[model samples]
Target chain A: MTIKQIERLRKGAITLLMLAISILFLLPFLWMLSASFKIEADVFTYPIQWIPAKWHIIENYKEVWIGKFPFYKYYWNTVKVTVLTTVTSAFVSALAAYGFSKINFAASKYLFIIVLATYMIPHQAILVPQFILYRQIGFFDSHLGLILLSSFSVLGTFMLRQFFMGVHNEYIESAKIDGAGHWRIFWQIAFPLVRPAVATYAILRFIWTWNDYQNPLIFLRTDKLYTIQLAMQKFTTINGEFYSLIMAAAVSAILPLLIVFIIGQKSVIEGIALGGVKG
Target chain B: MQKLETAAEAPKAKHISKRSSLQKKETIAGLLFVGPMLIGVTVLTFIPIIATFLLSLADWNFIAGFKDIKWVGFDNYERLLQDDGFMKSLKNNAYFLLTVPIYLAISMLLAILIDKHVYMKSYFKVAYFMPYISSIVAVAIVWQVLFHPSAGPVNQLLISFGIDNPPKWIADPKYALPSLMMISIWISIGFNLIVYIAGLQSIPKDLYEAADIDGANAWHKFKSITFPQLSSTSFFLLVTGIISTFKIFDLIAILTKGGPISSTSMLVWHLYDTAFVNLKIGYASSMAVILFACVMLITVLQWLGQKKWVNY
Candidate 1:
């Protein structure tokens, strides 16, 4: 074979190999998706039926979505908390990033270092005292408390500051020279330049909040206010024997995240790329 | 007198006042912008940390209210050494650290393979990254079903291959931690893979050309060029990955609840149980202090260690 032909053949073989690996990697999810459409009796059938002979998709999903402790309530709660948290975190982080990167304040260096230091202390270390403090302050067992817990992130501020630094000094300087206040320059010139970075942080914050089981698990006590993760756990426990229903609920819980991933795949890849080079 | 002074010092005084006012505006704006985060971090994180430390030295049942708190000094820390459950969890967390290097190696290999030769990179990236972004509750529940002892796909495949008694993964005490580790590896490899691919792409290609000109083989090129060039990314992944393993709670909570004889119990899960389930706030705070200390120690060690091997 010619050298070009040999190289082409090798690449083709690797592609085929990766295709096989992808299938293997995705088997569990594909199984979960397949099982959710199967009847209870067929869920564990021998020889592992990859497809349901008779589809029970509507019935299974309906039971999960509208049953006692309906999932829609939890979904609504999750959406509210995740959306509010993301918006607040992104804006607050961006504002802070702009301040630290662009504004020449005397205490900015020390303040930024302090913020970075806080990221080192894991949230798990403070849960005990936070629980007590929240209880004492009457913020316990509320969605508002849960939202406030993660709305201000040191990591978010730090990540956004890196991008804001890439915005040139000339833009802010010209805006200042135009008799614009710091606020006007921030809103018009600085923030727009780093909007993509802010959006990236917002997207990450959304995913983190949506998938958060720890905060809601601890802070929110009312069954009526449980988020999707909490609700999914409760549903699974109550219906442990019904794998079909559990599979359906599991699929419903992650469907939105999958949709988000699909729509924001470009930004998500960019976020990881940015994170890759961080020291 | 005012008119005479205005005429004499108008330009120089006006410039000084304008510059100071602008500096004042900038400082005010900076404070206003950073105020929310600063206050939130202080009240929410810093105060709580201090409270955790003070509470660790005192015995206080959260239900009993403030006046009942009893200061016991180093007693709680002393008890940690003798507590079997705490010891097991400590050991388990150390064991979980094994997943970091394992995933890092696997991801590095996959990253190299796909970065150079693959078609449809986006499809593969998304497919692999799916598990990383999916809700851990969903991921855990799905894996729970997948690891079912008798009827699950995994054991079914094992049976087909003539293994008489496949291990009961989550249920079996001996296999539970390993099973959790396997799931963790699966969930995390995609993230590591994505990051590694980004690092691989950033490597300068002329180094490879030089190596090829010198008659270097693939392994030699990889060891000298690819590995060293990618060391910083590797170190970043290593530190973040190890830190995350310390935070493994959702999977254990869903799958084992640190059960099967506390075989899969981890530090965070144990702290959660002690604080929330048992309401031993003081004891849990002591554990939290230890947890904080360990993370600080690991991070400091890694920071110092990076100077030797992690290339900037």
Candidate 2:
């Protein structure tokens, strides 16, 4: 074969190999989507039917929505926590980033390193202590407590600080010369420049807070306060089988996140790539 | 008259200079900006880490409050050393550590393959990344269904091929940890792949051109050029991957709850169970400290080792 033919053959072989591997990655999700529509009994049927013989989409949706599980309530709880956490954390971190990156201060470098080091500590390492402190303060089981814990993000501070540092000093200097105070310079000059990074952090924080299971499981005991992840866990009972119902519940739990991700996926990917490259 | 005027102006200039000192004002503003985060970390993070150490020395259950505490000193650590559950968790964590490197290698290989093959690149990337985007709880549930022993698809496929018995996946003690590892690998591949692809793209084109002029074969070129350049990225993935795998709690919680005879129980899961279910806060705090030490040690080791391989 000619060199051109050899190159073509190599490319073709690779595409085929990639297609096979991609299918493996996608198989579970595709199975889940198919199984959600299968009849409860047929779900466990042999040979793992790629397509359900009978469609139970409406029934599954109804049961998952209103039957035994209060999935809607769980979804609402997740939404509330995620939104509150993401917005508040992003805003606070931006202000803090501005302070760290722009304003000259004694001990700023050492203090910023301290904040970054906090991120390195595994979150679970402090769980017991935080729980104790929260119980003492009477913040235990309160949505406000969960919101506060989620919103206090050192990673967001570090990421936004990097972005803020990238903002040209000329704008800030010009703003400062115009008699604008530090806050004004931050808000008017720095904030607009790092909007992409802000949005990126917000999306990431939202997904993380929404999907968080351990914190909610530990703090919130009431069924009314349960987030989607916690609610999904409640689907299985001891000595009981409800595979279809659980699958339906799982689907419902992931739907909102999937929607949010698909909407902001382009920016999210870019943000993640930027983060990796910059680091 | 000129000398007198100069002397008077000097005092005026000094006064203005003192008044215009922006450094002090800027410092105060900087502190004010970072004040909330500083206070938050001190109260919520730094204090708690120190508190964890102290709490590990006592025997205070939340039900009994602070008054019921007993200072046992190294007793909790001694108990942990002797505890079978703790040993099992440590063993399980080691198993996890072993499995993660294999997954990272597979992910890196796939990433390099995708990078080399230009056609349908974005499509393949998205497909592989779909699992990463899905919620772990959701993914775990889906896997549980797929791994069902009797009527599940996996067993059925095996039976069709003339095999009668199939191992219970999450339910089987022997297979439970492996099943969790498999799911973790699937979930993490996309993330590692993305990083690897970024690493691949960042490699300078001149290196490849030089290899081409040298009449280097693909394997030779990749070995000499690609692998050396991607070393830093690999180091990053290795450190982060090991750290993450050691903290494997969510999947275990959702799937097995460290069940089938504590086979899948990892350090974090054990910690959660002790603190929450048994309410042995002090004992659990000790486990957390050990976990912290292990992770810190691994990270420090990796940081030191990176000097040998990491170019930048």
Candidate 3:
């Protein structure tokens, strides 16, 4: 055989291996998706019902969505908190990034160093005082407080600043020569240039906020105020015996994230690429 | 207005004053732009951390309010040394660090294979990355069903393989933390793989070409060229991955809730349980401080250790 044929054969074997591994990696999620459509007795069937024989899809979903402990409220709560937190975090981080990177000032270096250092202090380490502080400030048990907890991210600021630093000084200078003020230059010239980086950060922030279980678990007391994560936990405990309903709840909780990922995967991959190269 | 005034003034004086004025404007703008984050960090992070330290020194139930804060000198720390739960949690967190190297190795191998030989790279990337992006609550719940003692698919597969008695994962105390670690490794390999693949792509082709010219095989080239070039990415993933292990709360909260026997209880979960569930604010604060110290120590050690191996 030619060397090219041998190479092709090797590639074919490796591709098949990767396909098998990927299927194994996806099996749990596929099972979850499949189980959501199955009747209760069919869920635990051996050999695994890769596809449901008797579909209870509508009934299962309806039970999760409109039954006791309805998911729509949690969904709405999660969407509100995730959107607000992402926008606030992305904008705040971008503004800080631009300040640190583009607008030179005496305290820029020191202030940025301070912010970077704070990123090392784990959030878990500070939750105690934050809880007390929130209680004192009347922010405890409130979604507004939950939003504020993650809105000003040191990591986000630091990540975005790396991208902002890539914005050439010449552009900002030329804009300055055109009589554009700092704010005007930032909004028009600097920000637009780094908009893709900001979008990447925003998508990440959205995912983080959406998946956040700890904050909602800690801060939210009212059932009405619970985020999707909290709701998922609650639903599972209440429906522990009902596998089909639990699977439906799990799917409902994860479906939005899947949608977000599908739409924004290009940005997500770029973000990861940037992170890799930054190292 | 400043530019007009500077134009009308003496040339040398105007140049100096204009420079200072521009500097002043820039400083003001910089401060304004950074104001929200600066305040937010100060109010939310800076104050809370300092308060965490201070609160750790005093015994106070949050429900009892400010009037009840009684200063206890080193008592919480002393008690922490004797607390079995805290000790167990500390041990579990250290054990959980095993997952970092576990996933890193698997991801590095997968990354190499996929980068050079696989078809539909993005298809595999997305499939693996899905779990990383999925809510831990949902992931935990799904795994709960999969890990069911008898009827679960995992054990069912094991049964078919002729192991009649597969370990009861997540339900058995001995297997709970290990099960959590397994889930963690599964969730994180994709992110690590994505990062590793990117690192692999960035490796210069000339080095490989030079190695090929020198009659170097794949393993030799990988060892001398690829691995060293990817060291920085590895370091990055290592630090982030270890830090994330310390923050493994969601899975524990969902799957084990610190377990049938506190076997899966890590520092964060113990801290949460102490502070929220038991309402031992000061006790939990001490745990938090220990958590802070441990994270700081590990990070510093990694930083000091990196100079020996990390290329960048």
Of candidates 3 and 1, the better by TM-score = 1
Q: Once superposed on the true structure, which residue ranges of model 2 sit more than 4 Å away at CA? A: A238-240, A277-279, B1-21
Mark the regions of model 1 whose C-alpha exceeds 4 Å error after superposition.
Answer: A276-279, B1-18
Look at candidate 3 and give me any clashing residue pairs.
none
lDDT of 1 by residue, A74-150 (tens): 99999999999999888888888888998998889999998889888989999988888899899999888998998
lDDT of 1 by residue, B1-312 (tens): 999988989898999999899888778988998889999999899999998899899887888888998999989999999999999999999999999999999999989988988788888898888887888899999899989998888899899999999999999999999999999999988889989999999999999999989999989999999999999999989988888888889999999999999999999999999888988889999999998998898899898998997875
Tell me the docking grade of candidate 3. medium
| True interface contacts reproduced, per candidate | 0.76, 0.70, 0.86
Candidate 3 per-residue lDDT, tens place, B1-312, comes to: 998986777697878899999899999999999999999999999999998898899898888878998999789999999999999999999999999999999999999998888778889889888888888889989999899999889999999999989999999998988898999999988889999989999998898999989999889988999888999989888988888888889899889989888899999999999999888898899989988998898789888988987874
Ranking by TM-score: 1, 3, 2
Clash totals, every prediction:
0, 0, 0
TM-score, candidate 2, is 0.95
Scored against the true structure, residue A76 in model 1 reaches a CA lDDT of 96
Q: RMSDs, each prediction?
A: 2.3, 2.4, 3.3
What is the C-alpha lDDT profile of model 3 across A1-279, one tens digit per residue? 999999999999998989989987888888999999999999988888788999999999998999998999999999999999999999999999999999989999999999888978989999988988888899999989999999998888988899889989999899889899989888898889889888888888899899999899888899999998999899988887898999899899889989999999999877976764211
The candidate 3 chain A region of ten consecutive residues with least summed lDDT is: A270-279
- Write down the lDDT that model 1 would get: 0.89
